[model samples]
Target: IQALPVSKTLQLDLLLGTTQRFVRTEPVRPLFKQLLEQVGAGLGEGQGLDAMAARLAAVEREQFQPFEDRHPFVWKNLLLNEFAYAMFPKGGAADIERELMGIVVKFALIKLYACGLMAHRGADFSLDDVVRVTYVLSRAITHNRRFLPNLLQTLQDHDALRLDVMTQFVL
Candidate 1:
């Protein structure tokens, strides 16, 4: 696959580019949303994060069809495993609300990553679509789950870089 010129300035261009291809061709949003819901539901009635982590560790990995004629990929499994560990790095239980927040933020990060990857392909999303997606994610976190201030700040900090790449793509 030919890399878009803007891809050079974007980190993880190849991985994100591959991910973007899958994102464009497949129903990835639903799968990601479902997985997030399933994991969130696993924290029912104040369940401990450790328990949910253990459950995720045992769950089978999901396979997604790659773009065009490429072979299927197991990215979901990697995300699940890595996020599970990252959520509770010290191997201890966190408050259920906090745990759910972590899950929400992680999913949001993945979505953001996908958006960045789309830019790598020179696929421009409308500002309205971007606002809608941001609203949806923020609402999801604020409504049923806890808010993550740190994650929000981190995302905000990347706004300049994101805009720079988009500007480069546009130019």
Candidate 2:
């Protein structure tokens, strides 16, 4: 474990790429295609949305969900997880608030991008139409989930990184 250095990013791309590439002898082409298909399906169905604007209407609802069943971290803690704590520094309630904010923020951005892509794909509804339906009921944006992202950005602009600010969890 000592040989591994902490990373600023969630390291999603690098970490996933490594597994999808050299680690497997089958090559990267198939995995890439699968990834694209997964994204396409989500956009097409107006479902399976991720870190984006049109999601998490019931943030607190999802929080209490079972991890195996759905979003389990809602209203829960992130820091108690050894893996995440190792990646992010440390904090208390404020840190958890920041983490939740980040989750909401990411979901909003992803929803925007997905809606755009889905609209461009010649789906029946216009992008605006889609947004109207999606965003109207969205609890995240209504609650100003953007503040979380803005806070993170503010901290980043100061040339300092918070212990729990780098896409890691808080407890």
Off by over 4 Å in 2: 1-90, 124-151, 154-171
RMSD of each: 18.2, 16.0
> Per-candidate TM vs. native?
0.27, 0.25
What Cα-based lDDT does every candidate model obtain? Answer: 0.37, 0.35
Judged by lDDT against the true structure, how good is candidate 2? 0.35
| Candidate 2: residue 29 lDDT (0-100) | 41
Candidate that would win on TM-score: 1
**What C-alpha lDDT, on a 0 to 100 scale, does residue 53 get in candidate 1?**
30
lDDT of 1 by residue, 1-171 (tens): 124343322322222223333445544346345433432453221345345333322221111111211322323443475456555444456545445445544453444433432232222433343344444444444443223444434334655224343333222
Which candidate should be chosen as best, given lDDT against the real structure?
Answer: 1
Residue 170, candidate 1: alpha-carbon lDDT? 26
lDDT of 2 at 123: 35
